[model samples]
Structure formats: C-alpha cells, structure tokens
Target: MAAGAPRIFVSHLSGIAVFDPAGDQVGRVRDLVVMLRVGQRPPRLLGLVVELATRRRIFLPMTRVTAIQSGQVITTGVLNVRRFEQRPTERLVFGELLDRRVTLTETGEEVSVLDLSVHQLPARREWEIDRVFVRKGRKGSAFRRAKGEALTVEWTAVTGFSLEEQGQGAESLLATFEQLRPADLANVLHHLSPKRRAEVAAALDDDRLADVLEELPEDDQIEILGKLKEERAADVLEAMDPDDAADLLGELPTDDQERLLRLMQPGDAADMRRLMSYEDRTAGGLMTTEPIVLRPDATVADALARVRNADLSPALAAQVYVCRPPDETPTGKYLGTVHFQRLLREPPPSLVSSILDSDLQPLDPEAELPAIAGFFATYDMVAAPVVDEAGSLLGAVTVDDVLDHMLPEDWRETEFHLDEEVATDGS
Candidate 1:
C-alpha cells in the first residue's frame, strides 16, 4: 500500500482511485492510451483518461503519475474542473494511418518516420502490447523542443494490446489474411487487390497456404492453383474438403488437374473422386465423412468417457448421434440422437436410449438445400445425421458448416481487446 513499493501487475490497474497530495480521491483511472509508430519497440504514452462525477473527465500525462498505492493513486498535480479541456476519446484507425507520417524520438531528438502498420492483439492473448511500425526517419534539428514531443513505438516491447485492428500495414494485412479462419478468409479474399492477394498467398507457410486454398472462391482457387508449385498445390488440394478439392480440380486445366490428382495421396485422391461423383449441391457432397456416433444402448457416463478419449473436430456438434451397428441396421431401425447437455444434467448410468429423442429427423444424401436448411432452422440442430435409403448413417452436416454455406460474404472482423483491468493503468 505504500507509494513506490511493489505494485500489482499492470493488468489489474483499473478501479483504483486517483488521489492528490492530500489523499483526496479525485477520479478513477479509466483507460491508458498509447501512441504507436510502425516498427518501434515502445509506444509513447498518449495519456490517461480519469472519469469523475457529473460526466466529467480529465486527461493526465504519463509524467503526472507519481506512485500506485493501496486503495488510491498519488499524482504530482491535481486536476481542476474549470481548467480541464474535455473531449471524446480519439482513436487512430487503420485507414487514417496508411502512408501517414509519425514522429519518433532517438537520442532525445524527434524525427519523422514512415507509418507502416498497426496491429492490435486480442485481450485474451494479452501478453504483449498493441504496436504500430514505421520506417525510421532521418535525424533532424527540429526534434528537440522546450519539453514534450510526439513519438511512435514498436509492438515487440509492449506487454499487451487490443484485439480490434486499427491501423494495418501490408505485412500485417498479410499476417491477418494467414491467421483468419477459413470462412473468414473466404469472405475477405475479394477485398484485397488480386495482385496483393496472390502476394499474400505466396508468402504463406505450408499450413496457412493450405488453409487459404481451402477457403478461396472457386475462381480464385483455380487462379492461385496455377501459380502454386505443382507439388505444393497437390498437397493443399489433398488437405482440403473433398468437394472443395473436386470443384477446384474440375476448374483446373484438364492436364494440370490430372497431374495434381495423381500427385495427391491415394486415399485423399479417392475421397475427392467419391465426392466429385455426387451432385455438387447434394448432402453426400457437403457432409464430412467423420462422425461421432455412439451405440444406442450406451450409458451417458460411458458415452462421455468415450467423448473424452476421442479426437473430435471442434466443428462437430457436441451432441453424439445414436445409431444401430452396421450389422443390425436394415433389420433393426433408426435410433435417435443423445443431446450432450442432457448427459451433464442427468445422473450417471442413465441409459442413452432413455434420453434418446426418437423424434429426431434424418436427411438423405440426395436431399435439397432448402430441405437441409429447413431441418436446421426448425430443430435448432447443431448437426444432423445423413442416412441412406435403408437408414444407415453415412456422415454428418454440422451447423457451423451449414452456416458457412448460408451466411453473408462479409461480417464483422474478430476484434481483440484486453480485459478492462488488463488495459488500464494503476490508481
């Protein structure tokens, strides 16, 4: 609690009150603002915004902070209501910083730096600070002034930052393009210029290159496929969804497609061929071969035990599908689905069959999109079992996968932000 003694982690700085020399509580520290420049190691402190009663706010420079103490903070000076100049929070956005100039301090001299990009890491991954990069400017005499000057810093030095992206550079843009999930990648591919997109894809690592290929639009896939090394292209196509692979291959020049397919692993090639055999819009084509199925007679406890051991994909529905063994299928009958939540609520040893919702609807391989959409909309199902004419389970169509097919091209970017506590300065 003593001033200048060991303080808590920066992440826990919010809500602690600000106090003057007399220990009178003035306001609560609200936000810590840092000014960033591209490629710099440390960003300059813009200031702190202190929220007070009557909707009043005060801005204090970093230098004014004296020491963080128990219950309150000590400041070098007090803020008077009449003298304070209040304004809405100003944030520099990405578009505004593109090709802009920023100031940087070197040896106490100020210089202009070429702003390159700004990246905001999400709050969840708050180990590093948000950073912006700039090309170092030439040294000049104008930098040293009477006192304070503006400057930018790099991302490498800061402890943590916002997940929301503000300013972006070509390099950061490519980085975002690489890390985004498949559906997101697909949506944004159209936003960048074709040349820029190709450049981004070319710069990607193997895993990321494969992911981007899997998500690209059909036309873009063909365009990029031709550009990739033959072997590399084959590897990516092999890793992609079968239907996606087949569609892309179908778009390639006949000779190139044949060569690529021949180069792919035998098993992967077969899967692609099988999917290509089906109508492009059919359930057989859209469904993933992997399914999490449990015997109709298994207990909830036993099913959960298996769930714990299985290497299931995150895309799958949590609910496990109940099915008759392949041997007993035609002779037996359609069972039902065991909802995952129900297992958690019911005591162990509850028979999965006892909890089975026999009213569970099923879809056929040849089912239409509208029928699939209707089933998903009506039941609020996360995944539905795809069955044959004889009620034999084939695969499943997950809710997320279906949405990928149905959702709009552009949605919100995955914004990152540190927790309020983590983003603030101490009292």
Candidate 2:
C-alpha cells in the first residue's frame, strides 16, 4: 500500500444495513468481534457478526465485504434470512472519527481533514452513508440543511484530518507558516486561539519559529512567548533579530524577562540588551541587527554571494549594504547600498564601490516614529539602515514592522481571507 493514503477500517460494531437485489432493506452491521492475543498486544480480525430482522446473529467472514463507500458497506453474497441479536449500543457515531487519520491502500495522496458527504436512501430517513464529496458537484444549497432538503451530506465535517501523523493535525497545519510569506504568517497567528497558538508554536522547529515570530504583533508575541515551553521560548528569543528580541522582552514581566534572558546564549542576550539600551521610540531602538553588510573593496560578486548565503527572513530587502569592513566604524565611512537586482545585470568583476548608490539615506538614532515613517514614504524604500555619527551601522528598520502602527483591534476577521474548508465543532 502507498504511504500517506486514506484507508478505512470497519469495526465489528460498525453499523451495516443490508438490501436485496431489488434494493429492499435486509440486515444491518452488528458487532465486529476481533480476537485478542493471550499477551497484551494488538488484536487480530475475527469476523463480522451481522444482525438480521429475524433477531439472529449471522457470522460472516471478513473477506465477504466487497466495498465500503459513502458510509454504506456492501457484501459479496446474500445471506439466509434470520432474526438479529439485539444490539447493546448504536454503531460508532461517524462524528467521532471525522478528524481521525486514515491510510488509503489504493493511493498515496495525503489530504487535510475536510468535510464528508453522506447519502440517504429514499423512504428510510435514518439510514445514511458517508463518502468523499467532490468539490465541484452539489453547488447550490444541497449541502445546507434548509427546508425541502431531505438529506444532510456534509454532516461529517471536522476541524482537520491527517493521513500520515495521527495526532499532528493541528500542529502540522500551523507549522506550515514557516514556508508562508510574512504577511500570511501574521494573518494566521492572529486567528489562532491562545492555547492553539502555543501548541503549534511548540511543535515548530526553532529556526522556523523564529522566522514566523518576526512577523507577529507585539501583543501576540508576548502571549505566545509566555505560553511556550521554556526551551522553545529561549530558542526563539536567541534566533530572532536583535530589535525584535528587545521589543518582545520589554513587553514581558520583569521576572519572565530576566529568566528568558538567562536562558538565551550570552552573545544573543548582549545584542538584545544593546538595542534595548536605546530610547524605545528612537530609530536606534527600532533598528534590527540584520542589515546587509558588505566590504567596500569587495566585488559585486562577493556582495551577491553574501546575500545568497545570509539567513534572512522573507520581509528583508534585497539591497546589499556596503561598509569599509566589519572592524572599522560603518557610520560616516559607509560607501552606499546597491540593489542586488541591478548588480546582477551589471558585469561580474565590477568593484562594489562603482555600483554603490552613495545617496546615504540614513535614519538618525533618535528619530521619532512619524519622522521615520515619513522617511520610508519619501524614499519608497522597503528598509533603511540606521547608523551613528561615526559611520558604524546600528541596524536596519523594516517597512512591515512600521505598518503595525496602523492595524486596528478587529484585524484578524476583517483583514484576513480564509476558506471555510476546516470545520471546528463548538466543543
């Protein structure tokens, strides 16, 4: 059988109804009695004990089942008429297994938990079978249980389903944020419940979590950080941009802030403290440690190579920043920045200084928020490098973070577009 496929296992007690060649009602699925091993191990399939209207139990071998579809089970041959044994309880409710993972023997397609469609036989309002519903068919209001609708096909919709990892449905879905754009990641974070947010974050790989955390709101960052497991929280804090790390730490309680800082690597802790030492609203305070630094004497090729090698988040700029060298003051001595796109089109061996745009659009360490926002608007730049008077680079301010100043309270429902594919029950 292929991996990550959808398959179904019918329980002995799974409801099974029978019909004759003319489709007349005959018998129903009774108990699926499997024999357990003498030791504490997995059980083996025995046979199905179906019930007939005659109130007698008929034993049928498992091989007799021909097909199962839309919740209906079919047998290969008709059985002798007899009374059925009274059932102690109703068959397992379909809703109980909606979000459960299944492995299909035929195909390897792994699908998320989605709604199921069921079919009801005519004249019998009680009998229904669950099956995969093609997305294209049943366009109107057939799925919706309004008046004149005799059937409810999508009664089996669940929050989510998994075919490979049985218990990882929610975690896997949320962990996909690592591959998403920053805006999309932010949108998903805002919609998740507090508990769910923590659960998903705990499951994410540390580096991926750091990437996603860079895009979340400060309030959300504080909430998620507080709820995360200690090790995971420390990892996220260590891997994040210095400015982002400081902002999150400032929002946390004093005790938590100290504890988390202690957990972080010393170098990372010092970097965050450096950013935090500045006034909160200034450009230096808002700057990140992720500026695209390059040697002034290096070739354009060298700068491009460094840009490719850097482990930056998605929202960062493609512009390569030029400085004399890491050992020298990068402030007033800065050469300029060259857009990687433009540099790639030029000759490879060209000196970076020749390609650099020396305009030096700099943000002062003490600049106010409005002044900084206007600077972005004036330059049409996605990011601007902050520096001190001695030409040493402090950090880079990203445009997306600046936009957070504009978001309203009801942002998630109003700003994000989501499909109604995953169904969550009130419970």
Q: How far is 237's C-alpha from truth in model 2 (Å)?
A: 1.6
Give the per-residue lDDT of model 2 (tens digit) for 210-253: 77787776678788788777777988888887787888888888
Best by TM-score: 2
Which parts of model 1 are misplaced by more than 4 Å?
A: 1-182, 185-189, 253-257, 295-315, 323-335, 347-354, 400-427
Stretches of candidate 2 exceeding 4 Å from the true structure? 1-186, 309-315, 327-332, 406-427
- Score candidate 2 by TM-score against the native: 0.57
Task: Give per-model TM-scores.
Answer: 0.49, 0.57
lDDT of 1 by residue, 1-427 (tens): 2322332333234445787776677776544554543564544445455655332345665457666656566777545443234233433221122223333333443223223322223332111233444444442221221223434455353222322322222333333233445545554453344654555465555566666676655667777777778898888776665555776776667788778879999877776666666675667767765566777777888877756753454546477667777522222355777777887888888888889877877788898777888898998877887778877776677765566556654322221232222223323
| Global Cα RMSD, each model | 13.8, 18.2
> How does residue 18 of candidate 2 score in lDDT?
50
